[model samples]
Target: MDELLIRLRNPHERERAFSDMVKKYQQSVYYFVRRMVVDHDDANDVAQNVFIKAWKGLDGFRGDAQLSTWLYRIAHNESVSFIQREQRIAGISLDRIAHELPSTLRADKHYSGDEIQMKLQTAIALLPEKQKAVFIMKYYDDKTYDEMSAITGTSVGALKASYHHAVKKIEQFLRGEE
Candidate 1:
């Protein structure tokens, strides 16, 4: 990533650098977006938009954070914007999305999970958005609270609390108590 950033700054090498960066980060970005969106096609679209936005705004990148963090931030915002836009256009709420996620995941060609995995997805879907993001980043992505705080602009204390709440809720959901 450091090498890519160096190449990114050089006028002549920027294209190759961007290409390499995309190659390096695409799967992580896709999965990150996918976890939020559920539908594979929507995830693909939002992930692409994240990369495009990153490419267009690369010149303005201030290097205050790591490239992965910047990209994750973009992915995060784009995913949220997508859900908000969907809500506006389709009159669907987050609860509706969560309610619909299981069937959608089951229908998705990319999803090969069994019933338990589907239920876990449903549980995750039921989380409030911030908690969901925190859970996904910390548990699935194995990110530290500090890194999450930087990417999400949330306090570490809040993120930890959110994660704890999310875990408890997911456990409740999984145990069929919720």
Candidate 2:
């Protein structure tokens, strides 16, 4: 991590640092964004934007928060922006959209792993944006409520409530309950 900081400090070393950063975090970022947008192309675009934003902002990064937290915040904000823009343009709610699983996971072979993951993703997709954000940060990112509050600028209680509601909604969705 110190090596990454050092590499990040030197403009000459920025490329290598950025490359290493992407290699280390890309899958996590992609999965995070994918969970939000569901569409591969949109997730890809937003994930790219998240990295580009991080790269441009790297020089100003003050290390106040863990780098992963900062990156997650960026990714989260970018996803929200994408959703809002889509909503404004199309009058469609992101939460109402169906989850878009990878083609391999949607195959007729019906891998139990894929089926369960898809169901979970679909349930997540049905959550309200803030609740979904809290759920993903807590469950998927393994962030503490305090850390999530800091990243999201919400109180811990509110974050907890959101997560709880999100879980209930997901459980209901999974159970085929409206």
Q: What is the lDDT of residue 155 in candidate 1?
A: 95
Q: How well does model 2 score by local distance difference test?
A: 0.80
Worst 10 residues of 2 by lDDT: 102-111
Model 1 score (lDDT): 0.89
Q: How much is 73 displaced in model 1, in angstroms?
A: 0.6
* Model 1 lDDT tens row, 1-178: 4778889989999999899999999999999999888888999999999999999999899877899999999999998888778878998776777788778877788999998889889998888777888999988999999999999999999999999999999989889998
> Could you tell me the lDDT of residue 131 within candidate 1?
81
lDDT of 2 by residue, 22-93 (tens): 888898888888778766788889999999999999978887777777888899899988877887898766
Residue 78 accuracy (lDDT) in model 2: 92
RMSD to the native, candidate 1? 1.3
Give TM-scores for every candidate, taking all chains together and pairing residue i with residue i. Answer: 0.95, 0.82
- Candidate 2 stretches greater than 4 Å from native: 94-119
Judging by lDDT against the true structure, name the best candidate: 1
